[model samples]
Target: MTSDIALSVKDLKTYFYTNNRCNKAINGVSFDIRRGKTLCIVGESGCGKSVTASTIMQLLPTLSRIEAGSITYHAERGDIRIDQLARNGAEIRKIRGAEIAMIFQDPMTALNPVYTIGFQIEESLKYHTDLSLKEIKKKAIDLLRDMGIPMPEKRVDEYPHQFSGGMRQRAMIAMAMSCNPKILIADEPTTALDVTIQAQIFKLMDKLKAEHDTAIMLITHDMGVVAELADEVAVMYMGNIVEAGSVDDVLRSPKHPYTRALLDSIPVLGQGKKQAIKAIKGATPDPYERPNGCSFAPRCDFATKECDVMPDEEYISKSHRIMCANYKAVS
Candidate 1:
């Protein structure tokens, strides 16, 4: 309900129910995203990063259900609350591309292989805005051009196959912002692109965030991206947020064992004096069957018998908190 907070997620637990088992993808995930800032959700693959992103936008798949959560959107129009799982695809449709847009990881899979780029972008514009087809086409082209897609006017008529990977990603960005969404959820957007293109895309996103005042929820495993674009970083492990803080505080001097392990794994240029790469020991636990206590206990070096209890999030500062059993002792 706060004006400054763009999105507030409380007790978010999204689950995927199969015939065999019910997988708790996001377990009690909670966070607040302030307006016009990037909140990077970082974690390993299958740690419920994408699910959490989709849950925020109320865009979960048909079979998967939001087990529990209250996602509130504080918008200029009004405060909208969504019981993410309970809301049907039709109700959630009102938010997607209209208020809360999502830019998926792969543009090729996300974008229509059949429809022209212009048509797809224009379709969203038509649905959200009262813009006519002709007007929407113009807007779509402008958006494409803005995203640095070459000859967007001509390229608008082409299908997905016509453009390069970077260009296609740009098109996806254009499509995401077609309706000028307030909240843009980008799920590992720079994954497959090369370094140059990745830089370009990152710059483009920063530029767009500045110009549009969009609140971005960037979900990725890349710590480099977190350092560059994140105003705040929420480190997830298993299915829960293990640490949340400003980029400066947590990234510079991570308090949690999981976080420290992650940062230590990042290969630096001239720091070979230290030991070899210290990656987290254990693999991410199966979402269907989490451990008895702290999700990261299996891998946490600081973990003790006390970690058998549900670890409490201890606040390091006003802006930083770590949910670990041994943060104080480690410090």
Candidate 2:
């Protein structure tokens, strides 16, 4: 892996086994997260965005298995193949919170109801560092203060329920950053927040990334968030990445049919009054019943007999690539 690349995922295939049928949650997904940069993964629900995040964190359910692919983690000292590490091994345990941390979608469900927020943060600090109890508590308070929490000394001792939704999200960010992780995997981090609060969270993440030199792999469906924070963007459809490039390239000049349809569906302000948001014609295909050729062919208007054979990803520029048979037809 190059020095600029913090993490690289290649040919990742994660599947779930249930009742003798396999659900291909993530098939051949690949992307690179550059150091001190944000790579946003955007797609509709059930399109394997979250699954890819969880697979990187090794947090999948018991029945799920990574059938093929490798996740290379570029540590300061050397590179480690994360896929080959045992789920509960010593190295992975150290890597989870210390090297890579995840901020989940929901703070209410992610936090433990019993423990105080300070204790939770301290737990992460203790696991990653050999800090004493007093030092850990002080660091926990510092983290809360850094996250803009008021009365950090007192609020740090309160349970998760005592904090507001935005506060709780900040607390989650504090915990995820307690160890100063190299890579931060945020899965829909602002899903449950209001618009104003959402902006604050994005700003906080950007500030932290700049200060800590951290790489961010953000999974979200919000194009607004992508526009505000993403350096690179990858569009996923039915478990495959259809297009990937710099944020401007992917959002401004989308090549794939699915990518264009998604942008068209976004409601543009000041375009006109009383204009209904455009909706895609069909829903995503069932995971187990995906098409043999192009998984997106059934719903793609540009799909034709040529699409019967899956198209290889073609590079349009040094950093832009699209997986489609007729990218030129649309653009």
Candidate 3:
């Protein structure tokens, strides 16, 4: 692992078991989150972005379990390795809030409707910090005020329902940042908000990152967001990562066909003669029925008999990689 790696996920496989059959939700996914940088996980819906994030945070449901892989956290205590599958509740509890903090996709649902925003933020501080009640309250308002909430002194007393969707999202940011964690895992943080508000949230995150040097793992489907915020990008399809690389390498010159298709599907704004975006043809295959060879072979335009042999990872220099037989052959 690199000296600056804050978190390293190696060959992660999280599966769900039922009486009927077993399902693979995250298959052999791996990436590194470096200190003080952003790594964006991008894919269409049901691509296992949330599952990967939840697995790392050890928040998956009882039915689903981590089948393989090692999550290693490098800290002052040295490397803390956990087999996310076998970790006890107490161990997960320590890692969840103290070192890693998560911001959910929906603030309204994640935040308790009964509690005031101040109470929620203060609660996080109280759990993680040994501050007095007065200090916690002051920090809570400072967090809200720092997130640009208007009159945070007054609004901190308001409930979740009282704030607009955007404000609620900002308040969620306040709560997530209250502990000043080393790693912030945002699972679709800007999903429901409008574009302008989405922009603001990202800008705020970027500002905070610079100020605190926090490592961020952003899980989302938006390529624009990936282009804007990420230093590196990981593309997942049907629970498996097909490509991973630096943002400039992956976005500007994608080796995998799936990555190309995803970027091509985004509609262009200023090209005046409006035309429909070219979307990928097939829906993601069922998790229980994933293909035997390459998971993305069914949808790839460049797939071949080689794809039926199960792809292998090919390093395109030190910074770019793709799990594809064809891209390796041609590139």
Q: In candidate 2, what are the lDDT values of residues 79-129, reduced to their tens digit?
A: 999999998789888899899999999999999999999999999898889
**Tens-digit lDDT track of model 3 for 76-161:** 68787766435556766766777888999999899999999999888878877899999888898899989999999999899999
The residue pairs that clash in candidate 1, if any, are none
Model 1, span 1-331: residue lDDT tens: 3677888898898888898688888888889887789999999998889989877776778788877778888877777787733555576677778888889999989988999999898988887788777888889999999999888889999999998999999999999998888888999998979989999999999998899889999998989889999999999988889999999988988988888889888887677768577877878877777887898888788889999887877788999988888787766
Report the lDDT of model 2 for residue 135: 95
At residue 126, what lDDT does model 2 achieve? Answer: 88
TM-score per candidate, chains pooled: 0.95, 0.98, 0.96
TM-score of 2: 0.98
The TM-score leader among the candidates is 2
Q: In model 3, which range of ten residues has the least summed lDDT? A: 82-91
Q: In candidate 3, which residue ranges exceed 4 Å CA deviation?
A: 84-88, 274-276, 328-331
Top candidate, metric lDDT: 2
Ranking by TM-score: 2, 3, 1
Looking at model 2, report the run of 10 residues with the lowest lDDT sum: 269-278
lDDT of each: 0.87, 0.93, 0.87
